[model samples]
Target: MARATTAHQLHDLGLAAWFGGTLANAVALNKAAAHSGDAASTGAVANEGWDRWTPVNAAAIGAHLIGSVGLLKHDLGRMSVQKGVGSMALAKTAVTIGALGVTAYSRVLGRKVSQHHAVPAADGTTPTASTPPDVAAAQKKLKQLQWAVPALTGAIVAIASYASEQYRPEEVHRGMLQRVLP
Candidate 1:
């Protein structure tokens, strides 16, 4: 069994953090916030949690991107010669880009919603409702995006798993031969 490189470890750990964080936010944080009281309070609570998490999430994403580049550099030869590897890489890249976009859009929506709500300063007090039509629309969009972030991150995790399986020696050999032969 070969020891995993630093890049591989970072890539896996970063991805784990990204996936786990998104899922936790969706399942636990959002639900807890929704139970906080009215719509404004819910948005404020959820936004506050996400705001606290943004820095950590950004770091995880940075690490994952850097590690992915390093891993790709290390595997350039196999990427060029292997049959399925390039396709899987492309798929992973596409999903990653999509996830990034969704995350950004979700943040934008969150910020828009936050503008109308009175976020609690320190005390865990329920905020007053001030949901204008536009803010309500933004909140709706955010609700959908909340689930999307997790779904996309989970897809990335699945793609990473597939890529790992493709890295097996037997799989790599078969992939290269298939490219050359067919």
Candidate 2:
């Protein structure tokens, strides 16, 4: 019970951080960096912000993965017997994989932009007229990917909520009955 509780806490905390931080950055940080007075300063500001967040985000992802493994281990028997648990687990796993892939790709793009910190930029993911072609291309892709990361994470959160509801005592009883009767 303690192990399960810890795993649940870690999973929820890590996921919340990952989702909130990315969304905050996309919604405010990226755009706000442009207010630093110049295109070059904008790039520098955005680079610094994202660079600072990298390690923390990595830790959050690590925690989330560890917790996911712990929770899966704890829930294996429940999943085997419960009607909807296996499907929920499969769906959540798929979403987690998608979120991770998007996050990794976005980080790669971020690095491409950050490496050229002195380069001119309209904002974090927006390129200026004088921005180099390569960095500009990366920024263009990141502009799209920024939203994707959060959206997928948000989907994970939503799915996890649904899965939690499935664990209610009544839900479990009904699901088990359905499994046995049908």
CA-only RMSD, every prediction: 4.0, 0.7
Q: What are the per-residue Cα lDDT tens digits for candidate 2 across 1-182? A: 89988988889899999999999999999999999999999999999999999899999988888888988998899887889999999999999999999999999989988898777999999999999999999999999999998899999999889988987999999888988996
Q: Give each model a TM-score.
A: 0.85, 0.98
Model 1 Cα lDDT, one tens digit per residue, 1-182: 12237778878888888878977887788678767665657767877887788889888988888878877777777889998888888898899899999988877876776675544322122223445666667766766777787798889889889989988889988998999995
Those runs of model 1 whose alpha carbons end farther than 4 Å from true positions after fitting are 1-4, 37-40, 117-129
Error of 2 at 57 (Å): 0.6
TM-score for candidate 2, residues paired by index: 0.98
Please report, in order, the local distance difference test score of every candidate based on alpha carbons.
Answer: 0.75, 0.92
* Clash list (residue pairs), candidate 1: none
Give residue 79's error in model 2 in angstroms. 1.2
